[model samples]
Target: KLKLSLQEKKCSIEQKDRAISDLSMEIQLKLNEMIHIKTSLSGMSSAKTIIEAQLSAALSQITGKDQHITDINKELTDALTSIVDLKAKITTGEDLRKKLHNKVLELKGNIRVFCRVRPLLADEIVKNGDSDSILHLNILSENSIELLKGTANCDTSSMSGLKSRGNGAVEFTYDRVFGPKHTQADVFEEVSQLVQSALDGYNVCVFAYGQTGSGKTYTMEGVPDSLQDAGIIPRTVTHIFTEIERLKEHGWEYQIETSFLEIYNET
Candidate 1:
């Protein structure tokens, strides 16, 4: 009986030793598993941080690009607006110029005939008591001449030589002849006064009228012999140029044009 009891006690000790070894092996395996899980979690955390950083940087760049595009859009819009305003101003100016031109044409169309008279000689009259050698002055017509002699220093008397009249009806001195004077400026000034009236929205008409023997032709038409006595047509042209120059003194922009026409009656 004593031997049997000792054998049982030894068996109990061996079982306790086997149980301790199994417990130690299980603890080591659980520790290795925990280490692997920790390493994997760390790697995943690092990858997530890098992705988040990349996402944040990409978003910032997109925001900067969006701001640049917004600025470009604003500048383009401002440029377009400025261009539109300039076009509008140009259109208004053109319309104003057209209106002014039309007004000028209207004023010119409403004018009546302006009569210009030629200078006459005082000697053409006959006096009962005067001898043939004595010079006499006569008043011919109601029309009077515009003498520019007071304005210019030119001597008109040098043209006083008598020339053969066209019809031999009368003889006259060149100085006393009915015609335009040598003062080109004075003539232009006189005509500009009339043209300026049109610019002021007034009507005007210019004409020369007289009897057949009178100096009407000499006054209105230019003659080849007298360089100083050019007709009203040339003087009027100079007046227009002068007026254009005068108007330029102001800030107004203007343009000048000329057109000539003749009426021909076809039988």
Candidate 2:
């Protein structure tokens, strides 16, 4: 009886030991699962922080670009506004031009027109064998003579007094005072005075009009070869320069620009 009782006690101790071991193994498994979940959560938090930082940086760069674009747009707007205002103050050839023209006419200023003829060559006179060739002899045919006479007498009703001598010499004088003889400086002087008048708020136009081969170009432009043969253009340009220099003495300033244009016949 005593031996049997001892064996039963030993078996009871062994079962207790097995239960403790099983409890320890279950606690270890629960701790391991908690650690794994904590690790996953930590990784997710780090990834979220990195994404937020990148997003914030990208947003800042985009904002800066937008601000730059806004500044450029503002500058362009200001420039356009300035251009509009400047154009508003300027005048063109329309109602304003007509008003200016009327005002100029009211001043009763008359621009002088002068005519010059080149002297006939001595060889032509000798070839004609007429010492009187210089006299009232007409070089142009009758139609041309009539045309020239008409042009000359158009402004004034009186024809120039013409005296034809028996020796073929002719003397002619107009009723009004004649202009200074044709010189290289004549056109420049006349045009320069008109140009200077612009400072006094006057508009001026300088141009040439005449029949073909009538020295219109010669009078407007000058002969470049030599001073004796120089025409109107060079002389006037010199006059203009001198006038500008003279103007500096006064309290006047000028900015000048030149433009050239040519017209051609229709195709």
Predictions in order: lDDT: 0.56, 0.56
Clashing pairs in 2: 135-168, 135-169, 135-170, 136-170, 188-236, 222-231, 223-231
Model 2: per-residue Cα lDDT over 1-267, one tens digit each: 889999999899889889988988988898898899899889989999999999999999999989999999999999999877655544232336546655664463545444444443566456546442333224342112211233321222233454335442343332121122436554454455555455445666666655555466676665777676566556655656776676564434667676776443324
Model 1 lowest lDDT segment of ten: 168-177
TM-score of each prediction = 0.31, 0.37
Model 1, 247: alpha-carbon shift in Å?
33
User: Candidate 1 residues 1-267, lDDT tens each?
Assistant: 899999999899889888888888888898998899999999999999999999999999999999999999999999999988877786677557656765665565444333333343444223322233212222233233222221132344533453424532232222122222324344444456566665544556665555565554555446755657666666666566776676554434556566665333423
Cα lDDT for residue 140, candidate 1: 35
Top of the candidates by lDDT: 2
